[model samples]
Target chain A: MPYNVDAVFQIAGIGIIVAMIHTILKQMGKEDWAHWVTLIGFIIVLFMVAMLIRDLFQTIKNVFLFHS
Target chain B: MIQVVGLGVVATILILLVKEQKPMFAFLLATFVGIVIFLTVIGKITEILKVLAHLANQAKVNQFFLETILKIIGIAYIAEFGAQVTRDAGQGTIAAKIELAGKILIMVMAIPIIITIIETIINILP
Candidate 1:
């Protein structure tokens, strides 16, 4: 919960960076590279986000006691 | 919030630059960025879902209803995501089919809830 904002920043920053690289690659007529860049960026961000989701669910579990 | 906004603006600019030259890649880029943003906030979404689950439990709501609601939401999300992605890829027909599938799935999910509600009402009529 506390690091929620931090996670947002991290993921968004990655997204923007990926977007930038993607733009550059496209402008250079390297569509394939651009696509892979987007895919890789997505996977990296997804991994981090998956951790964040887990953390969030844990917090919710504590609050709601959904364990039982 | 600033970070999210900045990322959004940058992604928008990038998308604009890339769209015409490489429209297909641009769509994937957009989808990727969108998913990134969604992922960043997924924590909050889960929290809300858990809260709903808690409320359902406290109110002694039927498990069947809970499962059905979850499944319906899943179908809606999948359909919406698929349709949007296809539309972004310039495939309107595919998007339409995805939407139709989602609607059918929702109708199927609703049947049990409808029947249960009807049964509950009938029981109260006596």
Candidate 2:
């Protein structure tokens, strides 16, 4: 996939939104919800990064003639 | 090139803005941006390598040597990227280990060429 800045923006937006939710939930005395929100956000970003990393490794292997 | 720089700068600002509240996200953002930059330039690198390979073929250079050299370059690039990301995440020891591994792998990759050179010298002497 072509490199797009949209992923970066999406990740940053998620981070900001998650943080906001976490703060609001914690202030509401729902600490568990806050943690869950943060965890979900992190997982989403992790998946995105993992896919990108896989693409990168594939490209590197193809360019460098790495068969295994 | 300019687009890559602009993305980096924008990512940097976003990372800073997010860092105070979510350091993990900031780290992820850093990694994501790094990958994006690498991927963006990868096409150019591939084109350059293709041109280099064509030139080497024209020069009658050993294909084996060219392939090994390209592998070494790829390893170095990957290792550097890994080390930098780890360093950014504040894992100095892991970064150092990654670099050491890269160096060792490179040396291993060169051994065949080294042996060939020695054998060639021996044949020349006889």
Candidate 3:
């Protein structure tokens, strides 16, 4: 299967946006908010990656196991 | 493969750019890129495994042994991946522990095959 080029773009875009927001908040002296924003952004990206990892594991199980 | 490489290069550049101002975000970006690369190549890995299984079947290898070996390999790959990610996050001690666990699990998985080999050797010896 060909790679999903869009996923890469999506992740990088999210990272950039999150970093921008984090910087803005930090510069404004809202350190707590900045941290939370960065955390949330990281979690959002992590959720997407986690789902992909799950699918990968499912495929691996199907390939490696005889009963599956 | 080309797509993954391209994505990885982009991510590396972004991480380098962000690291000075925001180290935490840089780490997250690195990890996200790693996962993306892993996800993209997983399909090809499954295909290779399927081909290997087919070849093993054609050779009349024991199904159980083949399955066990495959599982062990999968465990090793996953453990190493996890360990490396943890290492990248700056937890070198945790990464070492992860690798140690993986090694122990792999040895446990191989015990049955080892026993069988020893048994066969004993039978052949005078």
Which one wins on lDDT? 2
Q: Is candidate 2 or candidate 3 better by TM-score?
A: 2
Residue pairs that clash (backbone atoms under 3 angstroms), model 1 = none
Consecutive 10-residue window with the lowest summed lDDT within model 1 chain A: A59-68
For model 1, residues B65-96, the per-residue Cα lDDT tens digits are 87677767656766786798778878999999
lDDT of 1 at B66: 78
lDDT-better candidate, 1 vs 2: 2
What DockQ do the predictions score, one after another? Answer: 0.10, 0.69, 0.40
lDDT of each: 0.68, 0.93, 0.76
The segments of candidate 2 whose C-alpha lies over 4 angstroms from its true place after superposition are A66-68
If chain B of candidate 3 is superposed on the true chain B, what is its TM-score?
0.92
DockQ computed for model 3 against the true two-chain complex using alpha carbons: 0.40
Model 3, residue A66: distance off in Å is 5.4
Local accuracy of candidate 3 as per-residue lDDT tens digits, A1-68: 43455665676677777778888988999999988987887788778767766765666566555354
